[model samples]
Target: MGLRSHEQLVVCVGVMFLLTVCITAFFFLPSGGADLYFREENTVHVRDAFIREELRRKEQEELRKKAEEAIPIPIPKPEIGAADDAEGRRIFVKQMIKFSWDGYRKYAWGENELRPNSRSGHSSSIFGYGKTGATIIDAIDTLYIVGLKEEYKDAREWISHFDFKEAAKGDLSVFETNIRFTGGLLSAYALTGDKMFLKKAEEVATVLLPAFDTPSGIPYSLIDLQTGRAKTYSWASGKAILSEYGSIQLEFDYLSNLTGNPVFAEKANKIRDVLTSMEKPEGLYPIYISMDNPPRWGQHLFSMGAMADSWYEYLLKQWISTGKTDDRTKREYEEAMFAMEKRMLFKSEPSNLWYFAKMNGNRVEHSFEHLACFCGGMAVLHSMNEPNRTISEHYLTLGKEIGHTCHESYSRSTTGIGPESFQFTSSIEAKTERRQDSYYILRPEVVETWFYLWRATKDEKYRQWAWDHVQNLEKYAKVNFFEPFLNSSPSYFQGAAGYSGIRNVYDSAPEQDDVQQSFLFAELFKYLYLIFSDDSVLSLDQWVFNTEAHPFRIRRP
Candidate 1:
């Protein structure tokens, strides 16, 4: 039969067909999921049909392999092992808000943060923003997020008492103001339809306009809110953080659109115009850009970490916030995402753990940050805006996988909290190997990603995983103060478990970091609450959040 004679084989096969059937079944369908041929059919016509089906089967197998490689996570029907996680999440969110709100009122009312350990307030000089009383502004929407309407109303009124003209007498961060204050105000207005919040936005924007007086149209980082002068010690000192300049566009553009003034949009869009003219290697912008010299990139650091994370974020968000009308901004985002794909993605060679790597220049630094986890959520949001369905699904799968890696970062830790910074190595030096930054400042990026993934996939597994994060905070970082419990002070001792920051995640029983970032309320818990709630809350297509977790509708420009 191995004679170079197809005619002889075909003639013999038609006469005695069993031999042909056996050969075709063994060769064509050995490793397949389903059988391709029957026991009876073995003539040339049947042989031709089997060959065609087998070729089609092989082609499908190859395509499946490629798709699996592209998106490694399996999107099975979510495991529904527990029903109580949702109820627990709802209870947990409200309880934490009440506890934190009461703590702030007792100790640091009208101040930036509650020092849970010390029960006092001070200039959060560590952040260099110098603005006092930011937590209240940031926390207002979190109360609303959890549907604590009575608390939200009280907090809203409490905030109305602060006079911006006098409150302006501090060193202010352009990024923090645009996010926690301006973004917060706009979100409050959107949620409540209150004119007072809108009024506050106008007042704050009036004072904030001066920060853009720089020649490059990029705003300086710090300004004297009272004096209308930029601080020399901040970005005005011939340096600018890349994230600070790039992150403000969403809030500013929203302000411009709602109010019908060109100035807000004009100032913010110039940063994009400047970005358009510059040279970005591999389509990547460095961590610092000179606000003074728009052409000269500042630091050599290239990362999706803290200093550069939101630079990529606002690019994608700008197009969405503008009702998808801005193709120029959309193109800019697409180019940056191409760079993100090329430069930042990595898998740990030793452990098989997927993680995004930080970069110095063109080299992989093998570093990771809790802050960079926001990229997972941002990736999902980016995919939603994409026109190509196949690519969108693939990116969504990538986001789910990345979120899994971030969850692993927490679960692998003894303290059950993620590190502020960490790195992977190409060594099998230990079975579960990585180095970590010692502290956990209660950042929300990882949990925020969990929310986005769960919301997109409707996977209860993501919700369960986020509840693990909440329990970690409950076990390790929670703190409380009651007036009756510790009567040693000028004021009080009232004990309640408020969500607070930790000094270090590496310590099994670490000391509290004491300074709860405003974003804990603005971002972390809000996302957690939304993930566990019903599907209708902040639907993905209807709303998009600014960098600080302030939600905005996809408004027509």
Candidate 2:
């Protein structure tokens, strides 16, 4: 019995010794059992706890960064006041007149563009040209004889210098010259007692009227100025903006009004019809289209920029002027604008400055803001006759915000217009890592925005902003290139310049014409300043007109 008990005890002791050996190998061995045992016994729980705390802290930090980067935006409602419709109409007409006159004639106009072909390869002042037409139309429609005289003289001189034969098509100058000189002349004659501006305008109009001969019903971008025939297929839908197509229609209207010919209005309607057929299923207009056929997304490159908005403006204007009140085309145009406002025109930075963009469905393309676009919005607002309280207020705020942001961003000592320099990139999550390319242009757009804001708000800050723009232009952006005729005499100046910047950072080099157009930029602020500073001399008659002749609805949600 004692021997059996000892054997049992020895067996139990052997099992216990094996178990200890196995435990040792598992805890201490670098591979297999030892490593696994060590990890499970000594490190897993403690390491996991530390990791959990670290991850939580990291998450909190990320949240804080996101909060810091967010900028607040205001979405105000537009309010309409007492039968200010008449007053609003007068304000818009006058403002348009003043803006067109002051911005172009006082600063730019015959300055940057010397004698048509003599332009310093950079005289594509779309606003300057477009506004000239606007000035003529406003003067004629409002029956301002004195205004017509100044405008007609400028119109005639502008046309006298240009043959329009060698102008570049697909280039903006062709359209500008055609609109301003051609359309301006016709409108001037139609309104006042001057036939010189009118006769010359008719000749130019006859030259430009053939640009609408494309299969797509859209006008070709480039027309042989001499022959007045279109030759290219660029940005078909881009003309939808009133500024783009408006001058053309206005010209046609001028022709029709003067000659008592309905054919001009008929031609204008053809453009309207063409754009109506090109609307997307969602009503978003493409940035560009083929001048030869129906618009396709393949031809949709560069669709929604500042120029594109002008197309919309003109379309709506056409519908109203032709008594297309119940027209589906007019309604679609209105709807598209609403989409543009909701999706694209937003203040991404704390400054409340508006940015132009392409919308991909519900998303606003908060990529960049161009000068022409800011002006486009202001022009649209003026035309819509919406009370200046909200719509105008928003644009005015945007201008102020943009002015603040631009002064802050381009504060460096650099010459030449910063091509695509004045952009708000806070909305871009990967903006820091992105490179500046074609889309990132720094040009006259920033200062142009300042001009628009200053004009609209009449705030002293805008004048200060304009002064800052001028200081920058004088300090770093000045260029002294001589004209071909007088190489030593320096015959040309650039108000608005090129699309590229130094080292290709975010802008382009300074251009003579582009830089001179900045003078036009200066002229706007100066005029506004003079008007407000010494109101006794300036006439509001030049600025105000009735819009009841062409009434249209201005709605908001």
Candidate 3:
């Protein structure tokens, strides 16, 4: 191009000179830092860049460490207690299970339960849904968990052929199946990291989905595992047990996340949301809920017993399992627990023993059960989360009191085993009345709470209490054919005369029930064993136990 004037020509010549310099620099300059200024030494700049890089690298590493800490990591069981003490208890428990299993193997090998005392072996689907040896399935993970390798391997092999599709109809309780079967398999998978347990769990979940097909997302109380058919009671239209609908969330939600299926969590959350949405007095809902028609208020028959115990349990545990991410459940559980503190908790004036009182329309029912004793453990669990030191100590106190009261119930009995249910009337004679609800059946709640408190406090007294209970159970509940009973030869209960299922804890030689509930093996002895073993194995910090005594590891989100 030609310049218009001498002034423009001079500007063009200046620009050309600058271009020539830049071209020369582009060809000759170093690769990294030759953009703007040049013709100067850059030793300081290079040194500064290296210092900045190192600082940046360190900062990034620090940030990575913080991120990892921010994510919750579950604490695993740390070996606790004196080694000899732990081993002794473990061996005792192992033998107990073996002895109990002897009765089971002979009488109820493939059945859900054993009629230990029956002349000819009687089997029944008590809590487990199938006659395909649900007890074996229920006990399998427990065996593996406690390191009973031989038993674990045997049970695993036997269970490999379990045909889930062929499970019988007309003999299933949905609540029981959810707690025992689904919880068991899920727990086993978590421990073994084995996908087989997960696959079987998914099968059970698929079969049970039909129960939740109800209008309100609440499952029916019972279902046939084979047909996906529900057992309809006259009350089945909208009614469901409080704990049944509410407690399955921990197991089912974990399954959902593990399997990458949202359906499980969706249905479980439906129940949780609906239950908490109601206008409850404090946080306690009625023991029953009608899914189709929700009730706002004025139904106060409350207890932390069989029907409603695990609802509170799952709420707190759900908060934990999700790594404290579920704020809603936390709030719900706290509110409900405060309500129980106000309504259900009763400090006896005469006995001065703190016990949870069942309520009937704002009045004290003056009753608690072996099943309800689990609340003390829940209270101890909640204390760990409470930020306020004062409030936390108060909860711990409450838990210990309830736990102590439960143990007293057993100690007061002749057999030193608590009844299935007991009550302390507010009036004269505040002593526990087993006549209303007697019979131990090897129930595990009192001892279970005792174990929790022992772990939390490391108090030697709790260990002593645990020892006494174990000694009593061994003396009274253990079946010895050598002793012929003096009084009509101990009640041959359930028509089977089985050694398990004690009908009377108030007698020197208590009558034995025929039906040995599967949970005796699954929960009672398992808990006792854990209580005596070091608290590190299946520790409370690292695991959450379903109602059926299945342990699930706490995972970070």
Task: Rank the models by TM-score, top first.
Answer: 1, 3, 2
- After superposition, which runs of candidate 3 have C-alpha atoms over 4 Å from their true positions? 1-86, 119-130, 231-238, 293-299, 426-431, 434-436, 481-499
After superposition on all C-alphas, the RMSD of every candidate to the true structure, in Å, is 30.2, 24.3, 29.5
Model 3 lDDT tens row, 382-467: 88777789988998998898898888787778887888777776552224554647787777788778878988898878877877
Residue 536 shift from truth in candidate 3, angstroms = 2.2
From the highest lDDT down, the ranking of the candidates is 1, 3, 2
Candidates in order, TM-scores: namely 0.80, 0.52, 0.78
Give the poorly placed runs of model 2, Cα more than 4 Å off.
1-174, 184-193, 225-229, 234-247, 290-307, 313-333, 346-353, 359-365, 372-380, 387-456, 478-557
On TM-score, the leading prediction is: 1
Backbone clashes in candidate 3 total: 7
Model 2 lDDT tens row, 251-345: 56546766676776687777666666665645566554444466444333233345464455455454544444436646766577666666565
Among residues 3 or more apart in sequence or in different chains, the pairs in candidate 3 whose N, CA or C atoms overlap within 3 Å are 116-498, 117-496, 117-497, 117-498, 118-496, 283-336, 493-514
lDDT of each: 0.75, 0.44, 0.74
TM-score of 2: 0.52
Q: How far is candidate 1 from the true structure (C-alpha RMSD, Å)?
A: 30.2
Candidate 1 lDDT by residue in tens digits, 188-233: 9888888898888877777888988987887788787667888434
Candidate with better lDDT, 1 vs 3: 1
lDDT of 3: 0.74
